[model samples]
Target: MPTTEPARPAHHFVAGIGAGPANLSLAALGEDLLPGGLPLFERQPGPAWHPGLLGAHSRLQTSWVKDLVTLVDPRNRLSFLNYLVQTGRIYAFLNAQFDAIPRVEYARYLGWAASELGTVRYGTAIHEIRFADRFELVGADGPVATAEHLVLGLGTHPEVPPCLPPGGLPGVVLAERLDATLAGDSGATGGQVIVVGGGQTGAEAVLSLVRRGVRDIRWLGRRHWFAPLDDSPPANDFYRPAYQRFFHNLPDDVRHAYVGAQVLTSDGVSLETLQEIYRANYEGYLRDGRAPVMILPGRDVVRAGARDGVVTLWCRRASGGSERHTAHLVVLATGRRPAPLPLSAGLAELVELDGAGDPIVDHDYSIRWKHAPRHRIFVQNRGRLSHGLADPNLSLLPVRSAIILNTLLDRPAFTIRDEQVYTMWA
Candidate 1:
C-alpha cells in the first residue's frame, strides 16, 4: 500500500481574524463576491458583541440603519431590518417607536446574523499569522487554515489605566465587569464607588450603580464637563463617505487637528443617557438628603492604591491642586486601544511602520506591507487617525467594508454614493 501524504490545511479565498461587527460587515458584503463565504476565526465561544456592556436600558448611539450590511447593501439578507422581519419582530419593533434601538437588541441582531452567515468558526483563536506563498493562520495545534488575503477586525479590549496598581487592587474592575462585580456578594453595593473616565461607558456605569441603589457614587472625568454627543447634521456630515474621502486626502497635521476638534462627535455620552443620569441624581437627592451620583469633572486620576479593603485615588485637578478620594469599588471606563496584531516575528518584519511604530494603513485601510501587491492585510477599526473618526464607528461599517471589498476585488463592487452632502470641507 502506498503511504498517504499529510493532508493540506483548509484554504480560503480570504479570512478574517475577528468576528466582531467590522469583520461581520465585511463577511456580509463579501458573501456573494467570494466563491465560498469569507471564513472568520472568532475566539469567542459564540457570537457576542460587547455583551458585558449591554445594559438593560442601553441604546445604540448610531441609527439602526447602520447595521452590518445596510448602508452599502440594504438588500443584503443580513440587514437589521431583514433580521427583524425574519425573526418575526418587524411589527413589534416598529410598534415600539424607539428613537434608538436597545443595545441588547442590536447584540441579538448581530448574533442572529452570525448564525445565518454559517461561515464563522467559533472558539478558534488564531495564535500567529505567518506568511509564505499565502497567509497561514496558526492555531494552538498547528496551521488551521490558509488564506490569500486577511482582514483584521480584532476589536478593542477594556483599557486599564497606568495609575492602577501593578497587580490590580481588590474591588477595582473594568467597566465591563462592574455589573458582575455588583451582582456578586462583593460588598461593593454598600459603600462608596468611584467611576473613572468621562465617556459613555463611565456614564453607563454611573447610571447602573444609581439604579442599583448605590449611594455616594463619585463620577470622575477628565473633561471640564460631561458633554452630550454632537448628533447634529453638520457633525454627522463628518461621518459621511464624501467627508471620509476629503479627510483621507488632507495632510497628516491637518487630519490630526480635525480629529482632535471632532472628538465629541464620537466620544461624548448620549443625551438620553445624560438626562437619565441627571434625573436619577436629582430624584435620589429629593428622596434622600444627598445625591447618589456626584459628578466630578476635570479630574485626572494619577495614582491609585488600596488599603483596608478600600481603593484610594489621587486625582490631579485640571485647574489647580490634587484631591484624594476613597471608595470601596472603583470602575475604569477609560476608553480602549486596538488589539495588537498577532503576526509572526519574521512576518511582522515585512510590514512598514509609521513614526508612532503603528502599521501605516492607507486610505483603503490596507496596511503598507512588502507583499501588498498580491497579498493584502486590510484592517478595520484601526484607521481612525488615518481615515477619519468614522473608521472605528458603527455609522460607516458598511461603507468601510465596501471600500475594502472593492479594493480586494479591484473593482467598484458596491457604489458608495454620498451626493446629498451639503457641507463643504475646505
Candidate 2:
C-alpha cells in the first residue's frame, strides 16, 4: 500500500462580517450547507440589534413570521418559533396578541439565535478584508481569520446631515439617543425642542418627548404630511419575491424612479405609531392648554448651526420662502446610510462599482468582483438600488438568505416557493 499524506483543514468555507439580522439570517440558513461552517465575525461583544433604539413601546415594523429562518427554513433549529419554545415564551408571546412583536423581543430572539451558533466569533471586529490566495479578515490586533468566501452585512450607520451643526453640542443628539438624553436632561421639557425628519425614527422621537412631558416639540418634515406606512395588501406585494424579481429586470432609470415613488412603502411611520402620537398630542392639549407636538410638515431643514446653548435651524418651506427656528435642543432623525465595506485596496479594486459608486450586486446579492466565481463576496442590506428596497427589509430576509445559499451551493438547497401570484407587476 502506498503511503498517503494528510490534507490540511481550511479555516472556513465562508466568513460573514457583522452579525446583524441580514448576515445572521444567512448564517442560520447556510450553516449546515457550508463545510467547515460559515462563521460570523461580529464587532459587538454579543448579539445586540439596534440596542439604542430598543424602546420599551417600540415594535418591529415587520411580522414575527419574517424571522431569520422561518421564511426559508421553518424547520431550522434557529427559527424564531424554536427560540420562543425553547425559551418557554411561545405561549406568552402568542397570548400577547401583538400586531407586531416588540423590538426588544426581536433583539432577544437574535441574541438567542447567535448564542446557538457556536461558530460566531463575537468581539472580533475585522479591520479590512484583504484578498490574496483567499480572503483574510484582519482586525486591529492582527489577523483574525481567513476564508474561501466573504460576506459583508455591516448594515447601516446614523447619517448626520452636513446641514447639522458641529458635534459635542449638549442638546443635539441622534434619534437613537433621544430617550436616554431626555431622561437625564431636566429642563428640556419646558424648552423648545425641535426634531428634524419625518420618518419612523423621527415620529418615535417626537412620541418619546411627548411622553416625557415635553410641552413644546416641533416635528419638522420635508413631506406635505407625516405619511403613515403603506401596509396595505397590494402595497405589501411590492415586498414579495415576485416583485423583487420583476424589479431586478427593470432598467436602472426605471428601478431608481420606482424606488423613489414608493418611498412611503418602507420609510413611512407605522399607522399605529402615528395614531399614538396624535392621541398623545390630543391628551397633552386637554391636560394643559397647549398641544405638545407641533407637526410642521412641508418644511425642509436647509441649514443648522449650534452656538452657546441654542440650536438654530433654517428651513425652506415647500409653499415658498425660508423660515428659521431656534431651539434649546435639536434631535436629528434624518436617516441611516449603509456602513462602508471594509475591503482592502486590493479587494476593493477588484469589485465593480456602479454609476452611483455602489457595488454592483447581482441577483444572488453577491458583488460582481474579480474572483467571484471561486471566492464570492456577498453583500447584505447594501443593495437597495441594485436589489430593491426589500434587500434591507426583514420581510424577505430568509428568502434572500436562501437565494444566496442556493447560489453559493450551486443547487436548490432551499426550494423558494412564492406561489399564488395574483398581481401582474409590469
All models: lDDT?
0.92, 0.87
The TM-scores, one per candidate, come to: 0.98, 0.95
- Name the lDDT value of residue 132 in candidate 1: 86
Window of ten residues with lowest summed lDDT in model 1 = 157-166
C-alpha RMSD values across all candidates: 1.2, 3.9
| Per-residue accuracy of model 1 over 182-266 as CA lDDT, tens digit each | 8886577888999999999999999999888899899999999999999998999998899999999999899999999999999
The backbone clash count of each candidate, in order, is 0, 0
Give the Cα-based TM-score of candidate 1 against the true structure.
0.98
Question: Runs in model 1 with CA error above 4 Å?
Answer: 1-6
Q: For model 2, how does the per-residue alpha-carbon lDDT over 58-123 read when each residue is reduced to its tens digit?
A: 888998889999876888999988998999998998899999888999999998888888777889
